[model samples]
Target: MKNPTNGSLAQTFQTLEEYNPALNAGVEKVALVLQTMALFFLIVLFIIELQNYAKKLNSDDGGLTMEIVTSIGMRYLVAFLMVMASGEILDFIMWLAIQASKWVSSVLPEGTYNMTVPGIKGKVGFFEKPIVFLFSAIAQLAVWTNSYIATIIIFLRAIQLFIFKALAPIFVVFVMSEELKSIGIGFLKQFSAYALQGVVLVLLMGIYPALMQNDFLAGDVATGMDAWLTNIGVFFLIFLKALVVLVLIIGSQNLAKRLIGGG
Candidate 1:
């Protein structure tokens, strides 16, 4: 049997990008039905807007002018086009975000130190310094747990992107009315934030290596007890650093949201 954990982080992300549960046949059919219903409602909204314009024309306000009609018609037309191409637009946004993240990672300085549990284990002798070995093992576990959590968050974000893609048509209908345009704009902002989460993750990953490059416990220890104490302190510091990185990775979505002015 194939081991699920054998996949690298990059492979996991690639899989997530390719996965599209929102495009399931049943979901697509449901979205189409909802889109049809929303289009009908859009038509009703446009008619109501025209009626308002007519009333204004009868009044001294002169809001029933050609410019107003043209604006309303344009809004409805744009909304219609958006609803039709919602999936493609969302896909493009996601692709753009992934590409941006890859570019950022490519530009960042690569770290020389091995931050993995196995890497740490290889550095210390298991039998000679059992206490230090224990610390390294614990650090390894912590690193693995942190990585797993980050992967889960990224996977969920991918799912959210697809869900947004599937529902874009309905939310975009709000753009047809001036009063409800903010709702549509808010949806787009939220989607953009989620899409940008990958970029935040890439940045954190790129920076983490540099932060962990220096070995605080590099020198030889004078005594066994002293070595144990020193290794323990170093391990504690390592844990603190790893914890900070993990927290940032988990909160990447919120960070992205703030970056894009999304609530």
Candidate 2:
């Protein structure tokens, strides 16, 4: 009755606070390493291509027309600019997705409720206290699940940001070469879908809370057991949807390739 979850719940939340930041920092370090490698590979590939192009230009059928030369220069210039502004561009795109998500959530019903015992200082019976405590714990579990989902959304967006930033040059080169253009288009499709994942997750998170709120209100008036069971069911559904979002994001690259006629 007197804060049944005092030690364990405090420890759990404390652990979350300590580890989430560590996990985020570690992921960023790994992302930076990968981004460096991607940049290196792009440079190597560009140099090799440039040499080959020079040899071709010196041949009898060589020498690019002003139009072709200008087009190629412009394409590389675009690629250069994109790579330089990749971070800002990515941030802007992510901001837009978050804004869209906020707009959608604004239209949905609010999903807020309280699940706690009130005035329990020698007022309620000892037996009733434990029961209320149990319900309160369950409600807290629901709250934790929501926070976990939000953490996942942040992690996913971090990953997408890394991918886009690391491959900004590659994406730009897609416009320069006909052979690699489809691959680039596929990459763009993949990027767009990945960005939308945040929106999808935001919307999904909103929906479950509303349903839980309805069930919670009804269950309070109806029966504690009913509300508990229904809330659990709804949270399970939310977990499953979260898994599906992860799968879709992971498999999006191949799907994008297929969609853009790339083998």
Candidate 3:
């Protein structure tokens, strides 16, 4: 029985040894085919990009050959520089926002204070307590909304970093072709606008810290029902401001596209 077991083990090892080369060969073949396909695709893209260059050169340019060539060259040069310095340039832009945010953070704790309704101090009516609580809940909701917006902005910035900086070389190729250069320039402008939102958000955060000493929803409970009512009104106005900020952030890319002459 031991001899049979040993023979079986040997057979298994031998079979595995025999299969290794075939498995490796199959993997290598697949890799080679995939690499070839990728090469073919890149070549196609290169051809298309070159064709765009040719089309632009042949376009009616009021016989300004040297000027057009020089302009295109300058643009490509700038694009090359951006590609090489993509990480550094973007990091610097982000650093500015970080610094601004830090300044805002230093001011935030000092600005916040406990919610108080001076109107409800002496005689608390039946609905007065509930109204105060309601206003408090609304204040908490506003804070939560701001947090949510900040999180979304951060997530979008991460995506932009990955797409613009990581794949900058690919985008740079687009910049060399007149037909595609607009797309490239437009993309860059849009990304810049997106990044600039961080500054705007920081400024908004700074405003409250500098101007507001306490929650806008906080009011004198002793002032009776009018206190919470005033807080709700203030909350709505602040919420409107938040909505405006969101709209600006979302439409920033379009604004950039126009500024860059994208359309």
**lDDT at position 229, candidate 3:** 59
Task: Give the per-residue lDDT digits (tens) of candidate 2, residues 1-263.
Answer: 01112222122122111325665455445445554554554555555656566678878577756675566656656655555554455546555655665566567554322222121122334445566456445555545555554565456555555556555544644544444667656665565555555555445444544544433343332244444344444445444544554455345445534544453
TM-score of each: 0.82, 0.51, 0.52
Clash counts for all predictions? 0, 0, 13
Candidate of highest lDDT: 1
True-vs-predicted CA distance for residue 121, candidate 1, Å: 10
- Tens digits of per-residue lDDT, candidate 3, 1-263, equal 01111121112112111324564345434433444443443345555645566676568453435565576567656655555554455456555545544454355443331212212233445665576556545645654465455556545654554455444444544555556667666666665655554445444443532333343424443455465556555555544555555565455445544654554
Model 3 accuracy (lDDT, Cα):
0.47
lDDT of 2: 0.48
lDDT of 1 by residue, 1-263 (tens): 11123233343234233664435444456567778877986898899889977887878666577888898899899889888876667767777886776677567764421355323322334455777777777776777777778778877876777677668888888876877889888988999998888777766765665666554535554454355666666676677788888889888999999999997
Q: Candidate 2's error at 220, in angstroms?
A: 9.9
By lDDT, the better pick of 1 and 3 is 1
Most accurate candidate by TM-score:
1
Question: In candidate 3, where is summed lDDT lowest over 10 consecutive residues?
Answer: 1-10
Q: Please give the TM-score that candidate 3 achieves against the real structure.
A: 0.52
